[model samples]
Every structure is written in C-alpha cells, then in structure tokens.
Target: MNEYLPLATLLRLLAVLTLTLAPHVGHLPPWVSALIAGLIVWRGLTAYRQWRMPGTMVKIALALLAFVGVLVHFDGRLGGQNAGTTLLCVMTALKLLEFKGRRDVMVLIFLMYFMLLTHFLFSQEMWTVAYLFVCVLAVTAVLIECQHRGALSPRITLRKGGIMVLQALPLMVLLFVLFPRIPGPLWGLPEDSAAARSGLPDQMAPGDISRLIESDEVAFRVEFHGPVPPPSARYWRGPVFDHFDGRAWRDSVPTFASGLSSRLELLGEPVSYAIMLESQRGRWLFALDMPAARSLPDDAFIGREGQLLARKPVTERRRYELTSYMQYRLAPELDEHARKRYLRLPPDFNPRTRTLAATLRTHYTDDEALVTAVLRMFHEQPFVYTLRPPPLGRHSVDEFLFDTRRGFCEHYAGAFSFLMRAAGIPARVVTGYQGGQHNVFGDYYVVRQSDAHAWAEVWIENRGWVRVDPTAAVSPQRIEQSIEAALDAAEGLPGHLAARTRLRFYLEARWEWLNGRWNALVLSYGPELQQRFLERLGLDDLRDTILALTVLGTSILAFMGVLTLRQFAPEPVRDAALREWQRLTRRLARAGLPQRPGEGPRDYAARVAAVHPEWAQAIHHITQLYVRMRYLDDPDPAGQNALVDAVRAFKPRSARRRSWIRS
Candidate 1:
C-alpha cells in the first residue's frame, strides 16, 4: 500500500480534510482552528509551487510551544474541552510535519477522528452530528486518496472515496442502534465537559436574573402529548429561594426535607413527556408544575420544594422523563415554619406601599377581597410594563411602587408581593419565563429570553396559592399572545430578536418545532428510561463497561475486514501482455523460423533475425515491447495500448509449438 501511494496527492487531500473539520471546534479558543487553517494554507501554497516543507526543527518547537500554551491557558487541567480541544488543535498543527507519505495521511485521518469526538464534547446537537458526519467523509476521502493516489487523478480519487463511505452506511447504523446506553456520568471522568450547559442557579443575588436575560440560549424545552397548554400556564417551577437578607436570596435549607418522594406519586392522568434540561451546574430539576412521577434514575431525587434535582450536580446533557399532573394540587396545608417564612418581610420596608396596603385593607372585608384591590390598582393607575423600565433607585420595592410605576414583570411582581404581605396576606414572587411560542412543527412549545417574566402567588383559603401577575394588567397580550405577539416596536431591537423579515418568521417557527421534539425525545434519555428501554429490548443490568467493549470490538473487526478485502481482491492490471508476445511468435513462424516456449525474449529475437534479417528490427522491437508494457506504466501512461499493435504485426516464427503444425 505504501509503495503504490503518491505523497504529493495525499498531502493535498489531508489539507482538505483539515479544512472541512474547522467548524466542529468553533467554540474553542478562536485561534486554534484558525492556526490549523493557516498551517494547511501554508502547506498548500508551498505545494502548489513545489517548495520545500517547513524545517523539521521549527515544527518540533512549535508543537512544544503550543502544548505549553494550552497547559498554561487551561491552568494545567488538561481535560474536557480545554484538553480535547488542545489535543486536536496542536495535533493538526503538528501534522504539518511528516505529512509526505501514506502513513502520514493515516495519522491525519486519526486526528480528524479525534476532532469529531471533541465536537461532541462541546455540543451533541443533531446538526452538529450531521456536520461531523461530513467531516468523517472528508477523512475517508483522504484515506482513499492515499491508496489510489498515483493510479487515479484527484477528481477520480474523490469519487471513489464517496462511493466507499456511502457503501459503509448500513454497518454504521446497525452499530448505533445496538450500542448500549451508559447509566451515568462516565466513570472517573472530570467535571468540565459540561462547560456549555447554562441553567438558572439556585442562589439569587440582586442582578441574577438580569444577566440571564442577556443570554438567548435555551435552558430547556417542552412538548405536550395532548392539546398544548396556554403560555399563561407555562410555569416551570425549578429551585425555591426563601432565605433573603435584603441583598441576596438563598435556599431556606441546604437539603430537601421531602426527599425523593417529592418527585414521585401514586397515580394521575399522566401528562406523559420528556424534558432535557441543560446542565445548570446545580441539582435542581426544571419541570412543569406537579411532576406525577420522576422517571430519571435512582440517584435523581425529588425535593419538597416541588423541584426535580439530581443527586449530584448535572454535568452533562441532563434528561428525564416526567408525567406532571397539570391539575394536581400542591398540599394546601402550610406548616408553621413555612407560613412564617412566607410572611417574613424586611422590617420598615416600602413605607408608602405599606400605608397604601393599610388603606386598602380598611376598604376590603377579607384577605381574598384585599388581594383583588392590588391587581385593580395596577389596572386603574397609569402603571405600565415595559422592558425599558425606569432605572430602579435605592429601596427597589419602594421606588417601583410610588415613584416610578414603569417597571417590568419583576418590578410589578416584587412591589405587588410586598404590598400583599403588608395587607396580612402571605405572598411570594415567582420568577420564570411566560408566554412560550407555539411551534406547530413538533406540536409543542418554546420559551425564550424575551419571555422572561415574574408574577405573584398568594396563599388563599381553600386554595393553596393562586397566581397573580400585575404585569398582566398592563400587558394582557403577553399572556394571551406570547412574547412575539406582545412586541409593540417593529423597528428597534437586536436583528435576531426584532421582527424584520418574513423568512425569520418562517424559520423560527420551523426550527422551534424541530427543537421541541429533540428536547422531548432525544434529550430525555435517562435511567428509568434506560431500564424501560432495556426492558422493551429485554435486557437488564446494562453496564457501561460492557457497552464500551461491544462498540470497541465491532469497530476493530470492521476495520480488519476492510483491510482484508483490499489485500485479497483481484488486482485490475493488464494480463494480455503474454498474448502480444505469442502474436509476435506466430508471425515469425509464418516467416519460417520457430522458437520453443522455454526460449528467452532476447534469444527469440536472435532466432527471428536469422530467419528473416529484413524483419529483425520489427521482431526485436516486439519482443522487448512486452517487457516494458507489462512491468512499467509509472509517471505517464501515454501510448499504453500502442505496444499491442506493433506485436500483432510482428514475425516471430514458432509454428510447431504455436499451432501443432498449422497444417
């Protein structure tokens, strides 16, 4: 294989392979992929004019320098994205050296494989999967070029490469379906692979949600099996923060009191679905209200806070199955401590709202009636909800209510809750997104940053707590029509968020539907589903080690099979050289001289010369022709078939052995 492959062609193909893999590692340090591209470009420019490769010592020094830079920049923790990316990037740079042979191309092919794995570490998105496949094809193309470099032109070599990988599709799919699902985070793996999952944190500082709004990334996605719930009902309860000290909010308790039972249940009309919440580096589960049963795994616990949380920090694409009962009621009976905590407010806070709550209290008969008055004030007053809210001065709850009535959801919810507590009603602010866009493509919903909302939930008689949104008083269309429909400005905003083109509308709707299905089904692969999945396939005790072994075994055997077929298959070379030699012999026999089969080519030419001296030059030419055509066709293949014509008309006399005395 090494003997046949031409070096120059392999280098060109490897350049193309490296270039094709550029986008997979786009999230890494910007210059990493750029440096690789630069290296490839340099090699190509040099190759185009047949210049010398960069000096060997220079390559060695660069590799050492790149490795040290990766170590120092990643702070010596050479693992996960920081490590995999470094390995891939530096390897591509190092590959520029020794890239002048078939084996060199093989090394590049391996590097490309590692690059694909690095892409998975950053994002396992379906589209990224598709692009990685294209990278794999490019790698395969280089391998095929290494094999047939000299025998075929670059265009023909690429065609052969495509045909080969396409033929390999069946085996790849068969292996993917049969691959076992690993039960947990890979054994002993480091924690940094999930550098990309950005979930809402449990602790709430003054500007916690403020920074989150700056991001348009999805925290999670939901799809309904039945008629989709209204955007107003899209309350995804996650972590419950109660310990507030005027400046920041923390958990009431470090550990959940309800334990795993909070995520489980006896029975209900199971709103069957899956949720793939991106890792938030915390142990909270973001689910629709009232999870009927927790279907993740034994380790994932349900807390009394009405939150689904894993036993450990979610360091990967966290997925779980849930059947939340939309109609299920939270325990209406509040414990002594829980009630006291709900009413606890900063002392001497919001003097004006406190006075107003007292005035309203005298006007209303009961706590429930007093609650209606607060919402009424928002509706009747000139209070407005806008993203561009007036900058809150000190004493936020006070400034928002009396001074600047122009506040967003958080402002309204905060001010409204503070007033309710003063009126002798236990209330808390609930902050989450509102009015999700309905994606008809997957028949589900998508919530975005613009949908970030806050509202109030008040404790009332008979009912545990009822939801109230003062912001809704100002923007009714927000709950009714979704964030997209609530947009009043058609001119200003980021191009991505602004409604500008009809095409944006079409694509957003289309991809929203597709992403909804991806989250619900694919992102939902977890433990309970793992067991049920195995049970459906009739396998128990699925082990990570076993799955790893099976995939490894199949890959090795398949690779061997490829090598064997290439070695044993018939070689497509010219086998007709002997016929040309025989033709020359027959012509000589007709000219009255014969030669034995054991005679050598030069000896036969001598015999022919004695028989007919005038035809000796033609006879001599024909005998030698077979040797050159049969053995040598390198560098150039012009006049490859012309040798046959010279032999056909030759005069090598051997009638006795050729035709058993043609008479």
Candidate 2:
C-alpha cells in the first residue's frame, strides 16, 4: 500500500502520543509523567532529523538504563500499584522508539486498556468509572482506526465506535444488574492485594484513628433484606481490643480456632442485616457486636470474647448477612486474665493520671458513681473535642487530660478506658467510624474514614459491656453532624472536603447516589449473589453461569446460520422465472400442446417435445430460452420478447394454456 504522507511520520506521531500519554493524564504520578513528557520531546527532535535515531547499541544500552530506572523507582520489588504503574510508564516510553507499523499502535491501544483497568483497581467511585469508560471508548476509537489503512478518518471511526458502544450499553447493563456476583477477587489473592492488613488493627497510637478520619473513602455499605435498621441502631461493630499497650489497645484473646459454640448462647430480639465492606486488608468486621447468625457464604464465627470475626482476610469487596441482638448478654462470667487485660495499665507511663484515677476510685464507692464522675469531668471541665489535636509526645493520656485537653475520639476513648482501668472497672477500646453523610437521594449512610471514632465499653454486673463515648460529652454535635463537621476543617486532607454550599451539596449528593450503586453492585459482590443469579434464571443448583453461557452461545450460533442463509438468497431465482414459463407455453400451444399453469419446468419441456414433429424444433428453442433467463439471470427483455415472436412466427405443434402472458 503506497501512501501519500509518510507512514513513518504517522507512526512517529503515534509514538509521540504514546510517550506523552502519562503527562496527558492527571492520575499518573508526577515523576513518571515528567519522564514521559521528556521522552516525547526527545523523540520529536529525532523525528525532525535534529538527531539521528540512537545507534542500535546505544538504544539497547538506553533501554537497559530505563529498565533499571523503573526497578529503582518502584523500590526494586516487582508487584503492587507502584511497580505496575512504573512498568506501564517504561513500556509507554520505550514503545515510542520501537514504533514500526499499525500493529505497534494496536499494542499501545491494548496497554491503554490495561491502564484503564488499573484505575478501577484503585477506586471505583462513580466519577472514576465514568472517566474510565470514556477512556475505554477513546482506546476503542484508536483500535478502529488501526483496522483501515487510509480510507477511514479517525474522527469518523471514533464516532462509529462510540455509537456501537452506546448500542451495547443496554446489553452490558443487563449483564451487570442481572448477572450473578461472586465474593472475593475474580482471580485469587487480588492482583494488587499486598495491601491486606489483619483487619483494622485492634490497637492505635494517638494518631491512628484520626489519620483514618482524614479519609472520605468508603469502609463498607449495608443494605437490609427486611426491616431497615434506624440510624441509631446501625452500630457496625468491628474489632474489640482487650489488650492495652500503655498508649493503645490490642487483641487480648487468642485467635479463634473453630466454632466456639460453647461460648455462644442466643438471646434477646435479633436484627438481621447485611454488611458489604470494602477491602480494608484487615480481618475484623464491623458488626453490631452480637451478630446472631451470618450469611452461609461468609465464613463467620463467634468468639468466646463475643466479637464476630471473618474466616479470611478481606482482600476484595465483601457482603455478608448478619443477625444481631442489640441487647444481648455477653461474657456473663469475666475471667481473671480477661479482667486483667481489660483493666491493665502501663506502669509509670502516666503516673500522675494513675494517681488521679486512684483518687477517683477512693472518692466514688460505687462503679456507677465513678462512671458518672468521669462523664461529668468531660462535661464540666474545660475539655473540648476538636479534630486538630495538639501533638502529644509521651504520657499521651496525661497530656490529653491536663494540657491540650482538646482532641478527637482516640483521646477520649484512650483516656476513658485508662480511667476505667484505674478505677478497677474492666473496660477496653472500640474503634469504628461514627456518623455519616446520609444520602438524601438514596437514604443510605455513607460512613467515610473521616467518620472513624473511638469509644469504650465497660463490663457491668447485670448488663453486658455498656457502650460509652467520652467525646460525646464534649461535643454532642459531632455525632449528630457528619464527620466532616466533626473534623471541622478539611485542611491537609487529600479529598475530604465538605459540601458546604447548596449547589455543591446537591451535586455531591447526586454523585454519591451514583457511587452507592457502584459500591453495592459492582465492587461489593459475594458468593450468595452469584448463587441467587443462577437460581433466578432457572438453572439447577449444580450448574454454573459459564456452562449456561456456553449453551446460550451455541444456540445463538445456530440461529445466526439461518439468518445468514436468508441474507444471501439468490434474488434471480425469486422472480418466478416468468419469462422462461411464458416462452415455453407459447411454443407448446403452437404445436397443439397446451401447457398447464404452475407446471414443473422438466415436465413442460418433456410434453412440448412429445407434440407434433413440425413444431418440435420451436419447442426446443423456447425451452433453451427459459433456461438462459432463469439460470443466467439475463436482463434482456427485448431478447425475451424476440424469442416470444420467434415462437409465434414458427407456428405451434399443439394448443397451450391461455394463461401464457408474462408480466
């Protein structure tokens, strides 16, 4: 294919586009973007003959340098987000030099698609999804352009491809909403799953939960199958840390082995609901503390310590059904070791505070009075709850109580648990987000990392561990307000700004409604949903979707075959071969041989020859004309009429049917 413009120039243009791709995107890291941009300039100069293409040896050496540079930039480990992104950037840059033909551009398009998938791996928020879809269309546009040489304009190709994608949208949605969902990652340990943790760690230093509070990213989403739980009833309890290291708390109990059925005894009214938690890389789940039962798909088991735990680390989105008793009795008998861990204090860490706790214990004879005095101190004292707490060095609880008494949930929880332990009351910390932006549009709570908070639970005589939040005594508005208001200022945060204005608030609300569907539907899929899908479609419990799709695919192929045959049917054969019939009948009638209407071609031909011998030749000529008109599809109306005239001119061997006229 000889070309007008140099294919070399077009190829170089594509190469430059590939090289500059990182810079074009905001999502790509800055250093990579800069390097890619520099490569584009260098390649453009080479294209202009400002410099010859680097010598073969030089190119090879430079490629090795780039490879080493990538390995270094990605911390030498070849996995996870940073490494994957670095590899993509390096390939994108190197592809510029190696550009040869259209196929190479096709490679770039494939890489672009992989890049889109990477974006989904990080965040599947609605805006990200919408942006990535546009990117998909763009890459698809490039794919279509590569298929044709010079005939198709890129603009026209893109438009056509977009139209086709739009046409395919209904089918995609039908599959998305109706198709079954499966729990866990599609493959295995998750492509980028080194991000796993042992659930939200049961311990936190001074800054842990507050740092969690800086994020607005989703932790989990819940949808109930039955009666909806009120907002106040929605305490998605997670980790219960009984072990306290001077500053933080930890998992005091042993790892649950199997079903501790002996430890569990069902009681009180149960509230059944489901929780779809995003991958936190942590093992502990946020339940309402006493989940009565769990989804069969989920490997949920209860601990003797009365906390619900997942069977595996959550590396992918998870959804599980849970039934909980908001008022269940747990650990009617608190063991001595459990009591010690719950009431343990770090020696000599906060001595003065310890002394103060001892004094409070001496002052208040009853445990109820002690709890009342602590809550009253928070209420009456100059203790203020604020997002930006002053940095505490050591003796953090002491600093929080005396000096910079203004701090968030962690401070309150840490101090409250510390004081309870000091008063000889067994208490431990509970960490989870409190309050969420209630979506007015969808009526679902969107608890973000910013909503992360801490509180204490005190084991009492008759009742189970009673929930208490010291922070609530300071700022009652914090729990009532969204976490953004609790945090007050959005400074130093990545993307956790509040929607303060009506317009922005409305826009944010609409965006969140869209995101909630994505979270509930796409990101948070599990095995139960997968089964329900197959069951709904009338498939046997034993069969799977892949087998079902196979059957459907085979049927489609068979139907397509019939349609294709109809599409290419011969039109010439369909005109009834009228000219041939007319010619044959006329000659037969001249021979005193009448032809019947709708008679077979072979039969008519035979009868005409059997007529009077004088007109036998004429009959033969008419039959030959019929064959040519019907088989060859000769569009010769005049020739056909001439043949008819010849038949009339010759004379008939027999009479024919009167219906011999041809339209």
Task: Quantify all predictions' global Cα lDDT against the true fold.
Answer: 0.65, 0.66
Candidate 2, 418-473: lDDT as tens digits: 88888899998877766556677876666666667788889876665778888778
**266 Cα displacement, candidate 2 (Å):** 6.2
Ten-residue stretch with the least lDDT total in model 2: 654-663
Candidate 2 overall Cα lDDT vs. reference?
A: 0.66
Q: How accurate is candidate 1 locally (lDDT)?
A: 0.65
Residue-level lDDT of model 1, residues 1-663, one tens digit each, is: 122234466466656666656665555566666776777777666556667766879888888887887777788867765676666677776786657765676777777776677666666667877887776766766676666646456577667667777667766654444456565544334556554356565565434554555566676666666666666667776666554455444566674545545323343565666566665566766666667554545666567656666777766556566767666545466777878887777776567777888899899968878887777888898886555566765467777778877756666776777788778787776666665665666665566655566667787765766678887787777677754455454223434566448788788788666765664456545554555665665555557435754776688668858876897887764567766666666666666666787888788788767755767777677666666766655422443466677865553344334555654
Best by TM-score: 2
Model 2 vs. true fold: TM: 0.77
